[model samples]
Target: MKTIIRNVHKSFGDTKVLHDISLEIEDHEFVVLIGPSGCGKTTLLKIVAGFIPPTDGIVEMDNHVVATSSKSVPPNKRNLSMVFQNFALWPHYDVRKQLLFPLNHHRYISKEIRGSKKERIDEVLEMVGLSEYKHRYPHELSGGQKQRVALARAIAAQPGLMLMDEPLSSLDAHLKQEIRNEIKKISLNVKSSFLYVTHDQSEALSLADKIVVMNKGRIEQVGTPEEIYNFPENPFVARFVGKHNLLNGMWHDDVFVVDGVRWRKDNVSEAFKQKGMIPLRPDELKIVGRGFGNGSGAGLGDGFGGSVEGLPGVINSVYFQGNQYELNVDTKYGELKLFEPLGKWQVGDKVLVGQR
Candidate 1:
């Protein structure tokens, strides 16, 4: 493991923030820690970067124990670079000077290493695709470009690991995705492990080799994007990672009973009977004409007196997203929302639904 955390816990005053957090990150892997606000993702990243000491636990990089019960190495000695949400670039320095300021301040580069500093500056500038703007001040660049400069500075040090705390969250969505690709390319080129922290699920899903999903200051689920999305271990994960409809169901001879209706299994039949869930996705539901084309069931089973047909629902709201129209349907399953292509969808239209 390039980076390892064992039994890490943190508390501020009486409130505990991170609880027994432990994870292993392989060298060169871009791993992301994702969760909602106040989940301690940023705190965990800081612990690895040696910005703040862990209350209790072990932090090791390359099998060298950096922080433990008694000893805490300062950030400079740990051989890591960190990029924050706010661009910590110096206002007084131009791009070229800002990138080299770290080595000059830390005095980490010896006379022998100093000979290559100019080429190193050029190398990292090109690495971040900012060779053309090496002379521009940070204030002259756009939000995404400033971040690139910050990234260039971090990479110029050529640390073994990089810690990012929502570095792209400040950019607009389109620019965020573009910079995200640049980040991915940079990680591949450097082959440096990244401990990324973000609340945005899309960012995490697109960048991470493995995602460590956090919730309320604890590790909830850790896996590849597909595993986290498809086989979520519990309700919190099922709802948090993607779109889902939560419905209560009872097991009845391998079938599930919801709202006094039995749902037959689409897969092989088995003997199961207990209280569980039936996750019905919106795309799984179909709209039958006459509000009644029962050609196939919706994504899930459990249609009540409507005879497993599309239940009647009114359009409570309509939102036009770029690629699709998000419809808020007021139905028996509560006010459920679904997305479809933009069209003549009124707020008072009677609609039918089906499942597949």
Candidate 2:
């Protein structure tokens, strides 16, 4: 389904939640709406799902208007299926019955699928790896298994579009990754366009063919995962999508000067330069050596007297991961974080921070 949302705006009484939102989801494309909570991501998804009408916009599916401000199509009338944040499985229904209900009674179920209901159920169950759990009730399943059932149920209808609202938010870290991979594979095998919503960056990055980043009821930017992560259009996207340290600085043409040090802004957006700030990812910085952080060579070099060519800061905190050390340092730019493989630094140690 090629869905288009144009001039979408939502409001409740005096508070406005969405502002002139517009985007497109291509057929069989996996588009993710990613933003923090209360940013209107779920609200937008509900609008597309026909749960709510937009206050002032039009929703078109394949060039036909399905929703407008005054009139809207019911969800069941649309060729789409939805998976909610919770499992939303019926307690009384076993897995097979759960999959059976949709095939027996959905408006959008194809006649071919309806005739071969049992085969369709088996195929979807195997795709989600829940073939053996067909007779199991919701109470008899693990959280991951329950989620798999939910996914299988959504896919069984064979809708042209699948809407998922944070389907992995309720799972453990390991299960989240496991189910995420399943979702990607299933999306491909089913040949259904996915309009998924999530606040998890990893899920959005790993799954989206295109990512729409929203903030304060407006779109900050729209791009692929690499474009959104490595080339944010604005400061909000930079800070929200990745672990970045926004350095307060001045831009002189291609040069960015911060705390008496100058760096080149290679391909950084003009939006950042206009705001007099630059976002440097944690990996973009390195701990060069120990220094006094006072712009003098008094206490510099490898605990010896030498000149330091980078910003000076004191280590504020240190966290040990299996492969690297996450260190927070207090520089004039503010507290910034950087990761290094060496565990030789401790809190309160003054060090020079340089760009990689």
Compared with the true structure, what per-residue lDDT tens digits does model 1 show for residues 163-264? 899999789989898999998888888856888998887888888899998999899889998777655665666677766555565765556655554545
How high a TM-score does candidate 2 get? 0.95
TM-scores, all models, native as reference: 0.85, 0.95
Please give the lDDT score for candidate 2. Answer: 0.89
Best by lDDT: 2
Give each model's whole-structure lDDT: 0.76, 0.89
**Tens digits of per-residue lDDT for model 2, 40-126:** 999999999999999999999878899999999999888888898999999999999999988977787888998999999999999
Q: Residue 352 deviation, candidate 1, in Å?
A: 3.4
Clashes of each: 9, 0
Error of 2 at 241 (Å): 0.2
